[model samples]
Target: MTTILVTGGTGTLGRLVTERLRADGHEVRVLSRHSWPYAVDLREGTGLAAAVAGVDTVVHCATNPRGGDEQAARHLIEAARRAGVRHLVYISIVGVDQVPLGYYRTKLTVERLIEESGLGWTVLRTTQFHDLVLQVLQGSAKLPVMLLPAGVADQPIEAAEVATYLAELATRAPAGRVPDMGGPEVRTFPELAGAYLRASGRRRPLLNVRLAGKTYHSFRAGGHLTPERAVGKVTFEQFLTGRFPARG
Candidate 1:
């Protein structure tokens, strides 16, 4: 069995990836700031070398989009090179290169770093996760009426499905940048909010509010969507039903 190190193994997607890898009988180690077994801080380079030592593959899912994702990527790449890792798999979001968001820009920077690191690498770009969409809905639910950005479309996939795919990628030979993955269905933000409201037994009027700015324009133009590569099977409705059962 090959030894694999998963960065950010305690986070939403990272936890799923770690569980899947361990279930498949691979020797797994998790590198995170707070997780037990192997606690490594990617941003500070603490315990990273030890965590990656003797590992055959390193799956990079750790990210700090708000502040220091680039630094974390650099630290991990350097440590992996020193430990002589055979393969490095990176999980990223779709539209990072096309969108002008600060977090997206950092993700693109990390992708470039991995490409030039001289290590065997594969990058998988997936769309947003269902949990993130639900968080957005929850944030908006506090308002008197749920207001959503007009013309914004999203293709949110299940995190577990993406984790399964990431595990598959880790076991295979590095293929560089692979095809993008997205949810099976696409829907506007308002529609998704409506579904969430219905699932939670909360009825609230939804208003389509027009937004301005380049970021809004990019999102409205479908930069966050991958219709042709919608390989994920779980739909938003299914995700809501699973997470929030109908009220009795």
Candidate 2:
């Protein structure tokens, strides 16, 4: 019964990780901003020491994708070290090193911190989640016509699958930088958007617009894809069907 502290325990992946760890009979503490039992903010370094103390491992699922991820990771690493944490498991996105996106850059920086922190650590880089992909599609569908970046491909995995893997990593002895995990299949943005529209019973026209920038170029080059590591079982179509069975 190892005691583990899971940061961002209320978020999408974190919540699933917490549930899986608890189901395995481990003592799990959840750190969130307003949640009970444990309340901690990684960005401000508040309530971190208390949440980390006496924990056997720290699973870092918390992230600020918009900005400030590096500072938050630094604070968490320092707190974990002070608490003498046995292991720190971090969840990162696939292709953080290869992608030129700002969020990916921040994740890469956090990976470096964990590597040089001298603490027992494991970093699992996974592809984007189905939930995130759906959110993006839903947001874009609001336009007059659904517009997608040409040649951009995504390998989106289920959040629950990633959560289960994270729990496995947290229990085992720390292994630095595990192999990347990706969805079972890779699809273009237009394909994904069309699937979403069909699943939602909306017949929105999709226009593939060629985007110009390093970000889109990297995506077009498959920097965000790990074809060899497509280990997830769920596909976008399956996810849509599962989520919107009536529409399907």
Candidate 3:
């Protein structure tokens, strides 16, 4: 049986990946900073060798939005090299190379680091997660008028769907930079916001706020979208329905 280690194994996506791998009869090791036994902080590099020891593949689902991801990856690569790991699977956002946002830039950087690493690797870039869209709607729920980026759009896929693909990737031979994964539909922010409002049974006026910046411009231009690769199964609306059941 293939032994795989998933970094950030406690998170939403990572948890699902671990489950799928185990269900397929592969040995799975979960590593998180506070998790017991395999608790290894990728940022610190300590305990990672033990965490990655003897693993056949590593599904790197861990990330730091605040910063320090490069250092974490450096530590991870070093440990994986020492462990003689066969494959390294990475989860990245679509348009990382095109987007100028700091986080996107960092993701692109990590992708490069992995590609250059001697160990076999696979990188999957997908659109935003449905969870992120839901979080945005929730964050703006208390406001009388929902404010969304005027020209931005989202093609959000279900995290579980992503996890399924990642699990499959882990079992197969490493394929570098697989096809981009996008949600089934390319929807405008206001349209998605309306969907969220309808699902929550709340009526709030939607306001489109245009911000000044290259980042927003890139978003407006659909730099983050992947219309050509809309392979995701669950639509954002479907995901919302699951979160908020309809009332009779």
Candidate 4:
């Protein structure tokens, strides 16, 4: 079995991926600022060489959504190369190319670095996670009347499924930029808000607020999903019901 190292392995997605890989009987190691129960951290590249000493592949899950992800990703890539890692699998988000948002731009720059490195690599682009939707609910549900975008289309996927896909990618040969993965159904922001309210048994009314901005425009134009390539098993309703299950 090949030795696999996961960056940011303590985070949501990375933790799931690490567990799945270990379950598959591979030698899985995690790199993070804080060492997990099963892995180590390669924070300053000081011990990265030792961490990846005999690793066959590196799964890059470390990312800064705000900015500066490009530099961080480049550093991780360089460390993997130095350690003689054979394959690198990068976990990215969908529509990173079309969005032009700060986070997307950083992800795009990192993708470029991987491409230029000439190492065996694969980029798995997944849509927004359901956790993000939960964040919106918990954060914005406090408002008197929640205002949501009129036409923002999103096809969010589950973090567990995304992690599984990434682990499978790490096991296979590098396929370059693979098909995008998203949820089964395409939904608008208003629809998601309503679903959240219903699931949570909240009586607050939702207002369909028409937002005017480049970001809103991009979202409304289907820049957040892969229409043809949307392939995920979990539906939004299923996710909601599972989280806030109806009492008997």
Lowest lDDT 10-residue stretch of candidate 3? 239-248
Residues 92-203 of candidate 2 have per-residue lDDT tens digits of 9998999899989989999999999989999999999999999999998888898888889999999889999999999999999999999999998988998998899987
lDDT tens digits, residue span 187-227, model 4? 87778887888888887777787877787788788887897
Candidate 4, superposed: residue stretches over 4 Å from native: 36-44, 246-248
What local distance difference test score does each model get?
A: 0.92, 0.92, 0.94, 0.82
Off by over 4 Å in 2: none
Which is the better candidate, 1 or 4, if ranked by TM-score? 1
Which regions of candidate 3 deviate over 4 angstroms? none
Candidate 4 Cα RMSD after full superposition onto the native fold (Å)? 2.0
Clashing pairs in 3: none
Cα shift from native, residue 66, model 4 (Å): 2.9
